[model samples]
Target: MYRSRPGATIKAIATDLGVNPETLRNWIRAAGAGHGRGRTEGAPAVPGSSVEADLAAARKRIRDLEEERDILRKAARYFATETGW
Candidate 1:
C-alpha cells in the first residue's frame, strides 16, 4: 500500500498509523523497498560489481600461465632427454 503511493513520506505514513517515523523507516529498509527513500545517509555503499569481472579475468590469466608453465617444463624435459643433459 505504501509502495503504491510513491509520493508518501515515511513520516506521513507513520503519523497516519500512529507509529514512529523511525520504526516505519526501519521496516521499509528491512523490506529493501526503501533504497532511495528514508535516511540512506549513513549506509555503506554496496561493493564492486567489477570485482566479479576482475576475478574472472584473474582466473583466466592464472589458467593461461599454468598452461604456459607446463608447456615450458615439457619442452625443457624433452630437450634435456634429447641432449642427454
Candidate 2:
C-alpha cells in the first residue's frame, strides 16, 4: 500500500497495511530501504574473495574462543571446589 501511494507517511502506510507503524519502520530498516524511502539504489556489491576468506577465518576464531572459554570455566569450577573455596 505504501508503494502504491509513494508519498504516504509511515502511519498512513501502517493503517493501510493493517500493521503497526513501528513494524513497518523495522521492515524498512531491515530491507535497507532507508527511512520513509523506497528501495536502495544499485545492486548490492558482492564481497571480494579476500573478504570471504576473512569472514571464514573470523568465524573459526570465534568457535575456538568459545571452546577455550568453556574449558576455562570448567577448570575454574574444578579448582574452586578442589581447593575447598
Candidate 3:
C-alpha cells in the first residue's frame, strides 16, 4: 500500500490515485490510520504511553481535593454551632 511507503506525500499519492489530496487525506483519517503529518515526518508515538496514567492521577487528585474541602466546610460548621455563632 502507498501508506507504508516512506516520504509518501498526500499530494503525490493523490495524484497517483487520480484523486484530490483532500479526498485522500479524508479517506486516510476516516480509516482510523491517520496521525496527522507527524508520523510521516518521523515523530512516531510510542506504544503504552503514560498520558492515560497521568490523566488518571490528575483526576484522583481533584477528587481528593474536593473531599478535603467538604470535610473542612463541615468542621467549620460544627465549630460555629459549638460557639453559637
lDDT of 2 by residue, 1-85 (tens): 5545777888988887899999987776665665545555563424366688999999999999999999999999999999999
List residue ranges in candidate 1 displaced over 4 A: 1-44
Q: lDDT tens string, model 1, 6-82?
A: 79888889999999999988777665667664334544333355677899999999999999999999999999999
Name the TM-score of candidate 1. 0.47
Worst 10 residues of 3 by lDDT: 39-48
The estimated TM-scores of all candidates read 0.47, 0.45, 0.47
Among all candidates shown, the one with the greatest lDDT? 1
Poorest lDDT segment (10 consecutive residues) of candidate 2: 38-47
Model 2 earns a TM-score of: 0.45
What lDDT would each prediction earn against the true structure?
A: 0.78, 0.77, 0.76
Candidate 1 structure lDDT: 0.78
Model 1: colliding residue pairs: none
Expressed as tens digits, the lDDT of each residue in 1-85 for candidate 3 is 3467768888899999899999988877755557744344443344334677888899999999999999999999999999999
